[model samples]
Target: MKIKKAFPPKIHNPETVNFNEPPAKLLERLYSSHMPRSYKKVVNGKEFFSKLDPNIAYQKCPKLKELLDKMLNLAKKSQSTAT
Candidate 1:
């Protein structure tokens, strides 16, 4: 007589199944973008455009720079008040 070997069960997670897929840009309105349409960019703590290029969006996006500057200034102001 031979004994059967036991094995652990595999977990089922729908999200992990698609882990190889590209990251989504569901919230384009707030994201910064750099393109030929950079002039149309809006970052007055308001909105942005979708389908932005990665290099430009993360690096040389003029609108993004403005938004980040505004955010940094706000942060500094809040920190000073807290102190």
Candidate 2:
């Protein structure tokens, strides 16, 4: 006798992401994503940390705004699905 292979459950609506968390937390997670580069520089015996500005990122990467919008939508959707 051959045993059947088990498969993961299929998602009903793949377009809508369900993070199972609050909108604030979801937005924080999206912001923490590696969209901007962070750098550390030491000058005149002083260390400074610089991060890519959102405006610059938007200008440099056209898809940046689109991605951010998608994440924002996901965060909003998560708010409704949050446990």
Candidate 3:
């Protein structure tokens, strides 16, 4: 007769699973709400198109940066654990 080894059951982490919102919607909202948009402006009798500056948004939105950092850290942790 052969003996079998049993493994422990998997644990569920609520932080890892989000059922309320999809990832695409979260990302879309993140960018749309926090990101700056380019627009046309008239300055000194000259018309110029302003370039979109990401720093402007970053400077204004600390929570956005925090969320992005947390997301990046989570992604890195998941990748490392997956392998």
- lDDT, each prediction: 0.41, 0.46, 0.46
What range of 10 consecutive residues in model 3 has the weakest lDDT sum? 1-10
Query: How high is each candidate's TM-score?
Result: 0.32, 0.33, 0.33
Candidate 3, residues 1-83: lDDT per residue as tens digits?
01001111432432343556543344344444544642212341132124436565455566766787799899999999999
- Model 3 TM-score, 2 decimals: 0.33
Q: Model 1: per-residue lDDT, tens digit, 7-76?
A: 1143243223334442232122212242223222255213324443545553555666678779989999
- For model 3, name the residue pairs that clash: none
lDDT of 2 by residue, 1-83 (tens): 01011212443433444678543344344434532532222431132114325675555554677898899999999998996
Model 1 clashing-pair count? 1
How far is 61's C-alpha from truth in model 1 (Å)? 0.5
Alpha-carbon runs more than 4 Å astray in model 1? 1-58
**Pairs of colliding residues, candidate 1:** 29-48
lDDT of 2 at 74: 99
